[model samples]
Every structure is written in structure tokens, then in C-alpha cells.
Target: MQNDLVSIITPSYNSEKFIAKTIESIINQTCENWEMIIVDDCSPDNSNEIIENYMQKEKRIKLIKLKKNSGPAIARNMAIEQAKGRFIAFLDADDIWLPEKLEKQLLFMKENDLSFTYSAYRLIDEEDNDLGVFIPPVLADYSSLLKTNFIGCLTAIYDTNKIGKMYMPNILKRQDYGLWLKILKQIKSTKGITEPLAIYRIRKNSVSSNKLKAAMYQWKIYREVEKLNIFQSMYYFMNYAYYGLKKY
Candidate 1:
């Protein structure tokens, strides 16, 4: 088995409230052959300080502080430039991962010779508590991708040799979604595991928590950005609506 290094890139801004839990999850991962690069986007709060304290104790954790408040996409791209791993993974500042996340995802990627893969994720509350269970579709091809972005960003892992580093989109909200589309266009196939590997925190104040705004951005991606026609837009829009309705 080829054991390639996995680099976890996290972009943060004023995330002191959850950054520690996020870092601790990485510290406790069963797959230890991984390094975490945390890019702090000039957080006005103590986020950088908290990360610095952890970095003192853990060599695998590296922190990059920005000079100004750039969006998460810019922060992620900066971290990607510094990544040294053969496999690339992403973790939001507020999310947590199970210990076997990297181990299981890596095994699946290598065994299938898959260029990239993502898995289902569980939703968590603001207090690091589980909301319930949610599993994504076992995406086998691009057609499934068009139906919905069932592949959770936090659960995604990819072989850098085949797909290369994720190009962080300038668009703020749906940056991960955009990269997934771009990468899917390059790779022959992409898949997702049925198991939940990460915890997606749904904070009441998060950008994603706003249904209307989220839908607007989703519409922009499907209609304007991807430039899908009306019929194609409705097909994906309905898939989005189905998932949104299921949340309640």
C-alpha cells in the first residue's frame, strides 16, 4: 500500500470559539501521518493566539497569519501553497472529525485508485453536540454530482498527483462547491463513502444557516456560474430543495 502524506488545510477568521476543538480533533486522529496547516485571515479575536499555543505543543500543526481580512478562499489557497502532503484534505474551523477519518478515506482512495473521494458527514450543533444523522448519496459519477453536492467538503480527500491542489475560488460562500465542480471536470470519476466521517457544525449565525441566502448562492452557482439552462437548473434546484426540506 502506498502511504502518502495527508495535509489538512483549515482557513479561519475570528474562530477562537471553536478552533481549539477543531485542532484537538486533528491531534486525536488515528491516521497520524498528517499535517495541519491553519491559515488565520487576520482574525481580530484571539484565534491566532489559541493556534499558536497549540503549535508550541504540536510540530505537525503549522499556522499562517494573514496581514488583512481576506476571505476563506484566499486563506485556503495560501495554505495550499505551503502544503507538503501528497493527499489534500479540508476541515472548516468549526468542524470536527472522527479518529479514523483520514485512515478510512485514504484506504478507500488507494484501493480504488480513485483520484478524489468524499464521504457523508453528521451534523452538529453550536455546542459540539450531534443534531442527528445525515448520510450523503454514494456518488459514483458526474451525473450524480449535478443532482446535488452530496459530497461533504470536510469529508473530502484527494490524490494530489491526479487532481492536484484544490483551486480556492474567489467566491466567498460556495468556494468548496466550486472547487468540487472544477476537480470533477478533470478527474474521470469521483465517489463518496456511505459512512459519516466528519462533524459539520451548523451554527445559528453561520453563513450556511441562512436558508434564503444559501439558496441564492446555490442559484448563482447553478444558473449564473455554471451557466446551466433553465431545465438543468430546475433539476439540480429540486435536488437542493429536497435536501433542504429534509433538514427540518
Candidate 2:
């Protein structure tokens, strides 16, 4: 499909502290045929200036600034709309990828003829200290993923040639999970690579770090987004809670 070209979608908002390092990580990737589309949601900081500096030096880096501040869902969707590569991937503004991440993951997908693939990743604190690796299910389908989300958006890649361009739901939280579920509904399952190819930054007091809030958002996903009945939602919510404890 597009000769293995990968489009990296990044949504940024006031990410001055780690955005430079994140962009550098991509600059150093072993895979060369890729375009990184970064969308800024009216960041009230120097994030735009830093990205603009990169655009001058790097032609592969494209930046889009929204007129008003939007959430990650809209920002990512804007990047996705501009993406031209056959492979759609995600990397947040604060995360860093290993040099071999794109190269290795692309090969993994092509070699196995897989449409969707995600990998394991290690976590880093605000100071970039290692927090340990999180392994996802080796193979996850729609039903199993309904229990808990194992695919980290930072490590996920889906081939547009195989499944077409899929966008995330317009929710404030758990948008990645919604996209993964939509993709799984189209395909049978997605393969997982256990190698830690990316680094996820865990910022203190981040909204996503709240377990109760995450659970509630996940419940809304099951009820409103997926539209499962009461009994089904409860059944899956139990699995989600158990796996949540085991995940982080």
C-alpha cells in the first residue's frame, strides 16, 4: 500500500516540556518513509513555536493549528484527515519512541500480513524514569477488548489499505479505546508485539491517572458508545475492573 509509508498522528496542547524530545525521537527513527502530522489545539504555550521551528528544517513534519482549543479527539482527527500514508500510527506529544520502533513495527505487520498491530511499551515518569513495561494481550478481538483496552494508542498502527481510514469517536476520554473497538469490529483481531518499542510518559496529577474517572469513562464507552445492555455492561465492567488492577 503506499510502499510502507507511515503517518504519525500527534495531538498536542501545552506540551512544551516534552514535545521537543518526542519530535527528536521520531527524527531518529530507523524508518525513513514516514510523515508526522502534528495538530495543535490552541496551545497557550510555546508548543507552536517549537513545532514551527521543526517545520522549517524538516519537510516531513506538518503542523496544523486549530482556530480554537479542542480535545485530543478532534486534534487527532484533524491530523488523520491530513495523513497521506497507508499506515496510520499515533504518538502523543509527550511520549518518546525508540529509534527502531517504526522500522520494527512495520516489518512485523508486513511480514505477518496483519492489518492492525500494537506493541508493548515501558512507562516513564515526569522525570523520564523507567516505571516498568506493560504487556498487552498477544491477540485481541472485539469481544476481549470490550473487557479492557490493551492497545496503547502510542504503540498502535493500522493499515489504511486494509481497513480504510478510521477515526476516533468525539469523546473527551477513551477515544483511543473507541477507535480500537471500531477497528476490531471490522477485523477479527490485532496482533501484539511484546517488545517495548515506545516510552509512555506518566505525568503526576494527569486526568487519565485517576482510576475512578477512567473506570467511569470506560463504563460510558460500554453503555453509550457500544450500546450494550445492563447485564452485558456489568459483565464487561467486572472484567475491566479486574484487568485494570492487573494492568497498571
Candidate 3:
């Protein structure tokens, strides 16, 4: 995986408070060959200015400003369309990666000859304080992922050369889960790295914090997108709720 260019997709929307730290984490990465495409979804705050400042300092970092306020899925799809790398990785503007995240994950993928892979992550608050909680890695196949999405978007990396470029379904939430299911359907399974490589920031009042809303979206994914039968949806949803409770 040496000399391989990894395309990093970051969707930003009023994330001015934490985007600099996110950019810094990528800059500090041990792997140097990467292109970070930060798609600004018509952010009303100074997020564009902050991203521009980083782009000025680092040529590898590029910015795509949307004319309208689209959701994260559309913003990420824009970056995916422009991605010109063998590997496509997702890193939200508020999340962070360790220095060795890229290098180690690439090596793991190469050694295993895997098309899709994800690592464990730590949950942090808005202030970036670790909550002393870590989500463990799981070797997930398509069926297992249908039951529960153990793959965190911040730590996911997939090979475009193997499965081609895949886009997230145009959903407000759980778009990452949809993309994972799409890729896993094509590959044997998505391997997991047991080490914590990324930090997932859980901001108060964010969509992720709304359990009821998230559950509704998960149902939509199962019934509408995946077209799972009613019984199958209930079975998977039960597992999802159980795993989610266990994570916390």
C-alpha cells in the first residue's frame, strides 16, 4: 500500500469549532499520500473560511462549497464523485484520527488483501474529552451488519479499485450504514482492526444524540431501502437495540 493515494471525504456543516483539529489530525498522520476533500454543505458559520485557511497551507486538502444546503450524504457523494484514489476513507469534520491510523490500516488491508475494513474508536464529547468508552471491533459480514452497524464512519476505509466507487443512500441519518451494507454485499466480509484509531465526537443536540429519530431512520433503511420483510426487520432491530445498549 506504499505510495497509494487515499481519498479522505469530510462533510462539513457549521463545524467551525472543531474542523481545525480534524485537519490537524490528518496532517499529523504518518501516511503522507492522501487527498482530503472537505465538502462544505452551505455552512452558515465560518466553516468555509477555516477550511480555506487549511487549504491554503496544504495543497493536498481541497474544498468543495455547495451552493445549497444539502445533507451529509449529498456532500459526501460530491467528494466520492471527484475521488481519484485507490482507497476511499470517511472522516467527518468533527472527528479525529491518530497519527498511525492511515498507515496501519493500509498495511492491514494490504496484508489481508481485504476490500473493506474498519477499526475501533473512542467516543468523545464536544470538548474532545474522552468519555472512557471505546467501541470494540467486530468482523462483520452483510448479515451481521444488518443486525447492527459496528463500523464507525470515522474509522472505515474501503478499496474503490475492488468494489468501485459506492455512494451513500440519500438519507438524513444512517447513510454510512447504507454504504457499508452496499460494499459488504459485494465483498466477503469487512475485517476489523481491534485498536482504537479514531475519535468520534458526540455533540449534544446533534442528530446522533436523538435516539428516537435514529431508530426511525434505521426502520426506514430496513423497510424502504433494504426492503426487508417485517419479521426480518424486527429481528435485526432487536439485535441493533441490544448491541447499542451494550456499547454504552
Candidate 4:
């Protein structure tokens, strides 16, 4: 793995409207030693075309074309497999990172010798109007995370040197949560900053916005993926439901 280099994994599907700005956000970062690997999951839109246009100028931006319309889990796993960097981060086609995000977060990790970290972020609507800011817990461990997933995938980073490489389970939903849980099992806890570092776009039709469906997916992860028993799953699910309702 390339020391001190960050590999950003992104998944795109019909993201033509937001992909350009997303790529530009990375380009405008204060930290320069990063490669963005964007996987296009058989997008039948101009997403790949826009990415290709950027690739002509920015050699750091790479694209992977999936033969089939695989889910984001498969897309991200493909990027992780090919990552040449010691540090790994995640960004989606619609999110935006602040200019100082990488510079500050990297220093925070190195100075404190942290293996996993995430930060608070702001929420934006489809048209880019600000909704509100979110501040996650300052620190969390495997037990705390089972109740709810506080790490926003876009704001998370993990060091491969410490725990080797961790991959997400092949699930259609809650894959990001699964990965965070997997990492926490090895590390003492994940740290975070209260300052907002990224922008999250909340779409009306996002699968996560479907409360009932999301609850079901969470339950599946607790039972089927984590192998939690009936009572244990119920205990965690109840806590998740309470906090889940509190999320924006």
C-alpha cells in the first residue's frame, strides 16, 4: 500500500446531475495525495461521460465500469480490492467535502495515532439548500454502534496499516453500517470531530428515507449479518428505532 495516500471509493448510478460537482469537490481539496476511484454501476445516464471528461484532465480520477448493475456494496468492494493507498475513505456521487476536510482529518488521525475516524456533516436538499448540521458522538465502539450507525460513510476514514483491510458484507442495504461495525470489532473505538466536514444531500426518494424499510434492513443486519440472537437483535433494534427516528 502507498503510505500516506488516501484512496477514495465512490459509486455512481444515474448520478449525472451531481457527479461533476462531486469530482470538482475532490479536485479543490487542500490535500493533493489522493486518487478517486469511481465505479459506474451500469449507469444508463451521462454519469460516465462526465467522469470521462474529468479524467482527460485529472489523472488521479479513475473509473471502473461494471458489466452488470451491481449494488453499491459490490462497487465499493471492487474499489477496495484495487486500492493502492494505506488510507481509505468513501464518498458518494452526490456528497461534497469541505476544502480542509482531508488536510485537517489526516492531521487529526496522525497526531493522535488513530486508526478509524469520522466527522460531523451538514445536510443539503436536492437543490443545495442547507437543511441543518449533524454532530455524531465524539467516540464510539462496537457495542455503541450496534444501537445505531453514527458514521457517515462520506466522512469516514480507516488506516490499513493498523487493522489490515476490512470489507463490507454483500448486502443490498446498510452495507456502510456493516463495514463500520466490522472495523469497530477490531479497534477499541472510532473517533470523530464535532466540526462539520462534509455535505450530505438528502433526496426525497432515497431508500434510507423509507423509515419502515430501513428498520427492516437494520434488523436483518443485526440478526443475519452479525449473527445476533433474537433477544439481542430485539434489544439493539429498539435502540436503533429510537435514535433512527431522531435522525434528519
Candidate 4 per-residue C-alpha lDDT over 8-69 given as tens digits, one digit per residue, 9 for 90 to 100? 99999999999988899999999999999999999998999999999999999999999999
Sorted by lDDT (best first), the order is 2, 4, 3, 1
Q: 1-248 in candidate 2: lDDT tens per residue?
A: 35678999999999999999999999999888999999999999999899989889999999999999889999999999999999999999999999999999999998999999999999999998889999887998999999999898899999999999999999999999999999999997778999999999988876568888889999999999999999999999999999888776
Residue 84 alpha-carbon offset, candidate 3, angstroms? 1.0
lDDT of each: 0.84, 0.93, 0.90, 0.92
TM-score for predicted model 3 compared with the true structure: 0.96
Better of 3 and 4 by lDDT: 4
TM-score to native of every candidate shown: 0.93, 0.98, 0.96, 0.98
Which of the two candidates, 1 or 3, achieves a greater TM-score against the reference?
3
Q: Which scores better on TM-score, 1 or 4?
A: 4
Candidate 4, residue 177: Cα displacement in angstroms equals 0.4
How many clashes show up per model?
0, 0, 0, 0
Better of 3 and 4 by TM-score: 4
The superposed Cα distance between candidate 2 and the true structure at residue 225, in angstroms, equals 0.8
- Model 1 stretches with alpha carbons more than 4 Å out: 1-3
lDDT of 1 by residue, 1-248 (tens): 23488889999988999999999999999889999999988888998889999999999999998898889989988988899999889998999998999989988988888988888888989876778767776665655676666777788877888777767678878888877877877774667788888899998977678989988888888876678999988988898888788756
Candidate 3 has which clashing residue pairs, if any? Answer: none
- The sequence of per-residue lDDT tens digits that candidate 3 reaches over residues 1-248 is 43379999999999999999999999999999999999998898998898888888899999999999889999999999998888999999999999999999999999998988999888899977778646555678989998878888999999887888899999888899999998888885768898999999999987678888878988899998898999999999999899778765
lDDT of 3 at 37: 95
